[model samples]
Target: MSNQVCAPALAIRRCCSDDVHHMLPLMRQLRYPTTPSVLKERLTMLEGHEQLCSLVAEVDGVVVGTIFLKQHQTHDMMKPVTSITALVVDEKHRGTGIGKRLLLEAETWGKERGSSQMFVSVAGDNNITSKSFYEYSGFTCTGYRLSKPLA
Candidate 1:
């Protein structure tokens, strides 16, 4: 996808190495487990990767939001599926449409990748912060995501 200016102050575009230093901190803000080396490794892997899509939302040259995605085929489905692995808008920038624009862009990206479904999972059952946002964005509660640690 190309860079798009959604508002006079907001621009959304693909993430690049130049964004690494800025993005690492943002990920940490969301409590993502990452260090500079790990973040750089992940970013390098995403470079030229066909199934990967990562983006940043900038407000006047300052990075304020980020989203990462992956497109892949599954045995249970015919068309490819796009999973929203991570999405976080700066707390100060919330309620300002950054997340919504990112989501719309993600849908467009998924469609371009021939995906039939766009999926995302909030971290825990008791977490409702992002639930309403996803629901408002047209995501339905198909089922719950259950997990157990074997270790």
Candidate 2:
């Protein structure tokens, strides 16, 4: 007889203000540290925008993954582009397809919003895993993202 346990059901939905507490740890994993109040305020601001889509993945009702997608148009681009600003899955759920599901959902959201392309920026040359993941998901190395800190 097989002894494998069934995986919990995953629910993907819009993130609510109450999800801030659960999202803090996930944000920390992505290297963005902030207090609950700060995170909540940021989330609220994002929610007020129609071009932003913030989603959360919950397993057995516990939030375990998140993705924030934004749609924008630039002077050089003819059509709008959807940018994935943040994507993070819980450490324990890293290899469980949660991140991919979040990405797929983001793509759907973008397509429905008339976006012609999807974009994501991966910082740090050492983050090979993130780069590989995005590449595997059909993203190519288009160009470098240059930045300089301003005081």
Candidate 3:
């Protein structure tokens, strides 16, 4: 991907139903393609699900980064835990604080909702830059995630 950055005037907020129009393109950049119709439906569902939060960072009305956070309850932890299901920033806008800002929004939401822990699962083969970003952002390695394809 080319490093084509949009202008740097950022506005971060909870994603509204109408924001799906701007978000679909950004989601495509994340390699998860979807149509506006499908995205709108998903966003509507997400809005109603208290366990989920969908946030976006926009620069001059263009989405640059997105974060999908989910609240989790585990028997081992008395307090709820926040998990990052998805986090992505446009290739053009990397190195900017947009990604961090979006993440902080999720973290703040989690804390306000009584979360005791927060975590994000990253694939082992994923880019080091992303792993480094999580580490630099105060995340520590806890364990590995193993997967096997079933036939």
Candidate 4:
């Protein structure tokens, strides 16, 4: 007895709701809060806004990875920047270059949008593996966080 299978060639493209269902699970795997209600709100936001951007990675018409980018402007009035809020790839596809493609695509998208910088906020604890990935992908840690008490 044996199992047989075929791997589909991966392709990357702009996202649509059809890809959202698959993207949600990958989001959850990364500890991103996800529920029908939350996902619905996100999908609605994506559909209703031009400022929101997401890219999907597909294999044989199935979404296997995603990167979510939100455009933002500084209060000082400077060139727009993009915040990379989430990026995930199916566990089975990890390390196969799909995640890398999604990130590079995000950077390219930022460039196209005239973003002065791309930013991401991540937990402070060191996860060497994760840190290595970010560094390998050309992100640097700036080591700054500001907090102030609200009266």
- Best candidate, TM-score-wise? 2
Query: For model 4, how does the per-residue alpha-carbon lDDT over 78-144 read when each residue is reduced to its tens digit?
Result: 8988898777788888889898999889898888878888887665343566667788889898885
Question: TM-score for each prediction?
Answer: 0.89, 0.92, 0.86, 0.80
lDDT of each: 0.88, 0.91, 0.86, 0.80
| Count of clashes, each model | 0, 0, 0, 0
Regions more than 4 Å wrong, model 3: 1-7, 148-151
TM-score of candidate 1 relative to the true fold: 0.89
Off by over 4 Å in 1: 1-8
Relative to the unseen true structure, what is the C-alpha lDDT of residue 72 in candidate 4, on a scale of 0 to 100?
Answer: 91
Quote the positional error of residue 67 for candidate 1 in Å: 0.8
- Of candidate 2, the 10-residue stretch with the lowest lDDT total is 122-131
lDDT (tens digit, per residue) of candidate 3 on 73-134: 99999999999988888888888888889888998999999999889888744558778999
What is candidate 1's lDDT per residue for 1-151, written digit by digit as tens?
A: 9897675588888887667888987897778788888888888888778899898999989999999999999999999999999899988889999999999998988999899999998875425978889999999878887889999
Which candidate, 2 or 3, has the higher TM-score? 2
Report the CA-based lDDT of candidate 1 relative to the real structure: 0.88
Answer with 1 or 3, whichever has the higher lDDT.
Answer: 1
Q: Best to worst by TM-score, what's the order?
A: 2, 1, 3, 4
In model 2, the clashing pairs are none
> Which candidate's lDDT is highest?
2
For candidate 4, give the lDDT of residue 18. Answer: 56
A best-first ranking of the candidates according to their lDDT comes to 2, 1, 3, 4
TM-score of candidate 3 versus the correct structure, residues matched by position: 0.86
